[model samples]
Target chain A: MSIQIIKQGMADSIQDNGRYGYQHLGINPNGVMDPIAATAANLLVGNDLNDAVLEMHFPASVILFKQQSLIAICGADLLAMINDVFVPVNTPIIIEKNCVLHFKKPLSGARTYLAVKGGFDLQPWLGSYSTNTKAVAGGFEGRNLKKHDEIRFRAAVQKYDAVLNGKDCEILQWKASVKNFYAAGNILRITTGSEYDWLNEDAKKLLLSSSFTISNQSDRMGYRMKGDNLAIENKQQLISTAVTKGTLQLLPDGQFIILMADHQTTGGYPKIAHVISADIPTLAQLNAGEKIQFNIIGQQEAEGILFDQQQQLQQLQNACSFPLLKFKQQYAIN
Target chain B: MKSPLPYHILPLGDHALTIELGNSIDASVNQNCIAVFHQLKQAGLAFVKDIIPAYASVTVVYDVTAIRKEKPSAYLFMKEKLEILLAGMDLDQPVSHRKIEIPVCYDLSLGIDLQEMSQEKNMSIEEIIQMHTNKSYRVFMIGFLPGFAYMGSVDEKIITARRIQPRTNVAAGSVGIAGEQTGIYPLDSPGGWNIIGQTPLKLFDAKRENPVLLEAGDMVSFTAIDINEFHIIKGSI
Candidate 1:
């Protein structure tokens, strides 16, 4: 019925899809950095796409389950373990009571998502369970999960036991396909923003060809990138306007910043490009000091990729039902 | 008489569209922006998620998933619908304004940067206070942080630039002026504005139905008060 955090990991917090409609009030739509991975984890646990999940960065937490429950780990390959046994990612597993789950070492990606069956029993703020730490609102006390924090599950013990079928632990045969969601290598697909033409020819060329290193100053708000100085031809002051997640802004000093999940509602910098929604998860998984390149894609192509991804998610939702049906057939009484 | 406002509807991305009303801060332009924002919300577009109005633009964030269900292309559908709405829209419609009065204490202790600002501006403390409280300011936008309303074109005589070294944490409700803008800090955060006074009002309360006291289209006027009155208001809250 509940899980207790033995050791809080680095920047772990409960997040749903996001808190929408409040950007006008300067409220950021703080949520899971990688929505694709979060959705995949939820699907594995028989939860809705927008269900709240635990989003953890590297060097994540250790938890002890107080009751039997079904769970799924997705996103980064964090090398999670149950007691001494290794647990795999992208697959659903049933944990017995008193079992300890711990994550160790740096995996391939930066973030890991954990989804429990029936989602977390938490109140939503402004129609979302996403935590906005700056505002001190939403999620679990509006902050990152700390050691000794107890999270209660909405699922009943009897329901999870039915899925477990008297087994102490069980790993489902099926796994979520995540390879297609991420881009190959470090190239992030992007589309030209409204101010794309404001850059000089040399700066525009450098933007497309040069490789940029993610600076240590990067955070949930934005990724400060270090590369060639991209100068604008006009150097005119752009009026402050609405800036969304993935908007690539050019600072006055000619540096670049990619806005993220917790980006401000509006910004004054010139927006040169925007990372496609389909490729945001790939960008989110990249760690600081990691080198990445921008590959400009047409608007039509970006839209096509997004549509395909949504279709794949729909397929995943449909595919997950088979396992639920099998569990019911084997465990439910006639 | 005011001329008709010219606007451009540009795509922020696949999911969001921004209507650029003008490039500068003007009352008429902002009023038109607010009017259009209200109309769009009243239109009740099924795919629209969030509508954010700023100094010179109104960004409409829509749900691509919902938009795609009805049309073959999400962006095209949004663009077309928005364009149609804009074509038939009235840009001169008057928007209702809410005038809010905030009480501020300009005590020497509370105004952390008052001495520095007074020396820089070569003005007396009473003159500085008079200039700040005389004029009513317009809320251009609420940004930088939640409930932090960016308001005004402050009087030129009292206008000043941001501090070279920002304070590590400016106490919440501290009224500060930077450049032509003046705002009250809704939270204790790092800021560089020239602090002139402090208010007792809780500008932001998440528990309240409307978390932010001021929004993009409100009018704000400050009333100078003494330290004793500040304490009295603080205790009541």
Candidate 2:
């Protein structure tokens, strides 16, 4: 009925699209850093795009399914394994009861999302299942997944005798195409921030030309970038204002921070540039110390990329529905 | 109904747009921002996910997928709609406000920076406390942390700049001042404001009907209380 965590990873928590409509109350929208992978994972499992999924990082969690279930692992290629056998990501897998799941090594991205058949049975706080660690009030008891934590599935366990064939696990043939979304090759697209003109000519030139390394201090809240000092032409105070994810704020010391899923609702720093929303998934996948370059694009182009991504996701969902429904009905799975 | 102050809408990212009313924290400018926020919220546009009001701007976080379903370009669609809405809004007109009175204990133990502030301002501790409690502060924004309220224009006599080095952790309910602004930390977080008092009432409670205690455009007045009253109020809440 539930999946027990044999071992816990760093900051493993449940996340969805995000907690929204509460920024006015100073509540930050804490959600999955990489929406593409999270959505694809949910789509693969025949779950709603907003269904809660387990977000795990390197040294990922080791889990043992207490019951047979259909699940899909997406995003970071952490070398997923079940019962000592290798498994592929971006595809659904039916696992037998008591089969152990773990990651062997970090292969590609920084975060991996695992989605179950009918989503988690846990209750949502404030209209969302995403974990708000600061408030400690949402997602799986409002905290990171601990060792031995058993999260129940929303759907009842169904016997996958036909698919498993007495085997430990079986992988499906279909997989979501996720490569093109991260095809920017470490270059994240950006749009002009409101305070973009605040930067001096040299700083503005350096922003688009030079590369910045994601500092070790980077996390879900914000990614601190280390690069050439970017200074504003006029050294004056900026009033606190609303900031969203991908907001590249120039700190007082020339270095800047790119706010992420857990960013503060409002900030006072100067926003030099904003990473286009379409590239947030790609930016979220970059590991600490990875060098990332920025390319500024028009607002329309950025929105076009975002619209295309959403359309692709919708197409994937549409393609998987019939097959998933047939398979679920065959096995009496919810 | 029209906005007297000049305002412009800029795309924050592909998914969000910000309406900049002014550069500084003028009350009229913020009022205009709030006016726009209220109108948008009232419209209940399905594409708009959240509307956040800050000191002098309002940020509208929209759903690109939702917007694209109705229009070819999200930015253009949103910009035109927002422009039309703003054109008909009378930002000069005053909006109703909620006044909230908060009790604060100015004891030194709870206020770690009181002694330092007293020395820096060359004023008696009582005078500093008097200045803080004397005037009603306007909450220009709610941010930095959940339920944290940024209120402003403290008495010039007690106005202090942020500390050279911010403390690693400031306890919840600790009231602090930074330059012309004063705020209370609703959660335990690192901050740079100069602490002067503590409040027992929980600024934020997940179980409460309204989790956030204060919001932008709120009028907050602090009433000084003894240490015992602080405990009694704390225990009661």
Candidate 3:
């Protein structure tokens, strides 16, 4: 069965973990901006961690389900409604056939992920379903979802029915909480980069103490920040080098830019710092005009936080899968 | 053969590592960077996901989940493994090279910044075209966009800085030069380089087995052509 798009909102595309092994050719690893939420949604639907999901930005789309399916909506509280009835986030639910799903007013985060059972039956480009819009490749026709675009699912009626328990709409009891991954006061933890020594002492002080406002010019490529100017000790040009997602670059004008999922493979600006992996999801959810402070942490500390986050995700995966295994054992007819 | 060059391995967060070869952008240093990239890929490390080679460094991105499963720490495992690999590394080893000829049409209508560049350099348009086509430049890196190969060390006379006001849209296959580097735009995007000509060939086709026309460590030379020839080549493709 398939879902038909009635109205496409701001920007929505199919994404998985990310596209890899092509960075040397200048290809960006475009993928879901928030991995934790996306993975949580996938786990709720009994799909693999890297299974493709619909990453919808605020003011997202309206879809009509052609057949009954099990689904989960994670991340941003977009006020999702199924046939005029409100639904909750971070939980699995079943949608009856011919029911319309739409989003209302903007709520908390900037992105929301919708995962279906068995994942989407979309073709994978470069070994990934993640869309790279810049290259006009990958995902569904290499672009944002447009009105009337139909997406087919790898439907498993028996599996979804067992999860649904023959109900038209059912919400699971257990929900995956993303609160532990986010930092208090919107402070992002970062580690000094290779060129961190280039900044003067005063500049370093300003960077840590001052709060930076995210400019409207920010996008999936980078988040342009406005704050006190950071001065470098030397005026020499940095030889262009390899850069990756989360690299905080200092522009010529003394402004800051945090590279995001769709960032270029290499850059010429001096990388002053890099945000830790654990807090990347929080940063991804932050909207423009939001203020963020940087907290400098040692590399070892950053690694420790990342390890803990991964371990928590593994525990959640195990928790979600156990119930599904029991449901399958009871429902399957020999 | 020259002795092995000194390098510093720096961490680029928990999952990636940057190998800085040197401060300058020399051909030899870039070759060494490429050599290390090949060696690392040949190692077939289960943790390593991608390797990017630039002007003077190679950034290796790894899967932390996979690495952490085998070792207590992913970063430490990468550092130790790389140290052992580099201990026996030979920087002077001979490697194969590929030379590619790109056909360009330098018609004044197609070259938006040709006249400005000519005036700034105090050279005639024909002379500028001749200088651009004479040298076989080396590909230092491929970045900024997909299939955009950064070829370098353009003739000193023709070298010019980027435009103060970048154009809103630079068409795909447009050849441009900025500072000591020359490159062709694989996609239409905002750019500030001095556009001198356009190529009919598709520099990047995602449908192809190899999407990029050029890669790091390759040699590229331009062949000037007339508008009619450009149209002929464009139609044939």
Give the poorly placed runs of model 1, Cα more than 4 Å off.
A159-168, B1-5
* TM-scores for every candidate against the unseen true structure: 0.97, 0.97, 0.97
lDDT of 2: 0.90
Runs in model 2 deviating more than 4 A are A329-334, B1-5, B92-94
Tens digits of lDDT, candidate 2, A176-243: 87898784669988998888999999999999899999999999999999999998887888888889
User: Per-residue alpha-carbon lDDT of model 2 for B42-74, expressed as tens digits?
Assistant: 978768888999988889898887888889899
Cα lDDT listed for each candidate:
0.88, 0.90, 0.88
Candidate 1 TM-score, C-alpha based: 0.97
When candidate 1 is compared with the true two-chain complex, its DockQ is: 0.79
| Range of the 10 consecutive residues with the lowest summed lDDT in candidate 3 chain A | A157-166
**TM-score (chain A only) of candidate 1:** 0.96
List, residue by residue over B113-223, the lDDT tens digit for candidate 3.
999998987899999999999989999999999989999888999999999999999999899999999999999999999999999999999999898999999999999
Per-residue lDDT over A118-217 for candidate 1, one digit per residue giving the tens place of the 0 to 100 score: 8899889999999999878898889999999999987666455665566567787888888888999889989999999999999999999999999999
| Per-model C-alpha RMSD | 1.8, 1.6, 1.8
Segments in model 3 whose C-alpha atoms lie over 4 Å from true places: A156-168, A327-334
Could you say which candidate leads in DockQ?
A: 2
For candidate 2, the TM-score of chain A alone versus the native chain A is: 0.97
